[model samples]
Target: MADPTTATPASGKPGHRRRRVRDLRAMPGFTTTAWITIVTLYLPILVLVAFSFNENRSVVLWTGFSLDWYAKALENDGIRNAAWVSVKVALFATVISTIVATMAALATTRTKKFAGQGLVFGIINQPLMIPEIVTAIATLSLFALVKKITGLSGIGYLMLAHAAFCIPFAYMPIRARLETMTLTLEQAAADLYAPPLKVFTLVTLPLLGPGIVAGAMLAFVVSLDDVIITLMIAGPGETTLPIYILGAIRRGITPEINAVSTILVAVSVLLVILLFVVQRRMQR
Candidate 1:
């Protein structure tokens, strides 16, 4: 009548039962499959980073290690200008998206649930759910109409496009932070006759800082690396780093291009690390 799974071993002690544990590592080919997947995903990245340090002009050929390509990429005026443009656009987009996302998160999390709340969430996350190409095409069409009406052309278009798509990226973390927060402190402030505005600025905003920062970093990274949206929205003379890299690739791959890509990968990794740290702090 004893359970088979929890039955005691024949040679073991009478009072203790040995439970069966599912060992994924013991499965046939599990280790090999995992290793293959890891290597397949990361081998190209490893190759790219390695070749960035190669002294050879050819990306595939192995030569002596050198920093010459990195130097060349930095010294290139086109790359410098494109990098500057990317920074400006990313900064603008991050600020705009973060502010809007924070406000939206506050409104949704602080109030009573209303009808159409699910629809509102769906609308907010529409860009993330839809294909990037579709968003890019739709943004292009919208911006084209605005440009025609206003007779305007500038980097502002690209900034707005990036911000529009980045809103959901910024919103998710802020909303998650707000949801995990306890109502005790805010209720205490209310009981003490603190106005809602004062409670938010003095109590809520400080508590929400980590989420805001994480969201901003995420938005900044998304805006920085956006190729499809940037390509569709960029005006004449508004080339960004990704676009620059694309042009360079069309010409041919070189160590300089590899160096630039490696730098971008490094930057993205750094920002993601910082974001992880902030999220950990929020958990504490």
Candidate 2:
């Protein structure tokens, strides 16, 4: 009888030691590179968070843990006003961006590709490719002309600017989701003679919910943390949190800034987790 353990193929001496699949993280350089990258990116944030509660006023010196900085940050009128402005801008931008992105995604993804399809998509994503400073400068000049001609001014303009800038960020995920969706369900619904509105409202919107939520949250975060555009367009009296933080840091980094930074980081982390959870549930 032939020995099963010694089985071989033509010209193949018993196979070399059966190779096992290796996890990418277990590879020679991957783990080291990952650790180095993580530390480089996040060590400053970790240090800032840790020192937010420092008893000492010196940001670099950690005396002991205390919540005085947090209390002070909450009581600071500048911080509060800036935070409120950020909230308003972020909320308004998120709503407007999500709506515009959804319609754009639907138009691009659901329709037949034709002339100018590439142009349309390129325009939609132009903000991402152009230098942010260039966009900021261009927006400032346009707003300046508009102000000169129309006498328009206020936080509303800032919201509109943020919405316009955030549209591309919101469009990508929604478009990706729409592209991956199977047309079978929508076609099936139409075959039953259901109206377009009902078919979309009942069949398409539900499946697109996760992407919508993710896009809205992403837009909100981007708007909230925006500095260059907001700095260019915001009035002397108006400042969002990011602008406020940047100005403060230029003068000096303080514990109050650290406390606010920690809170912003925590909020961002929570939103990211929520997005992950929604996506996971959709997958299941």
Candidate with maximal lDDT: 1
When summed lDDT is taken over every stretch of 10 residues in candidate 2, the lowest stretch is 16-25
The best candidate by TM-score is 1
What is the per-residue lDDT of model 1 for residues 1-284, given as tens digits with 9 covering 90 to 100?
44554454563643343322334227789889999999999999999999999988877789799999999999999999999999999999999999999999998998999999999999999999999999889989999999899998888889888899999999999999999998899999999999999999999999999999999999999988999989878987899999999999999888899999999999999999999999999999
lDDT of 2 by residue, 1-284 (tens): 25443443442444431222223226788788989999999999999999998999997777898999999999999999999989999999999999999999999999999899999989999989998899998998998999899997887888898999899989988888888899999999999999999999999999998889989989988998899988888998688898999999999878999999999889888998998898787677
lDDT of 1 at 283: 92
What is the alpha-carbon RMSD of candidate 1 to the true structure? 3.3
Stretches of model 2 off by over 4 angstroms after superposition: 1-30
Q: For each candidate, what is the lDDT?
A: 0.91, 0.89
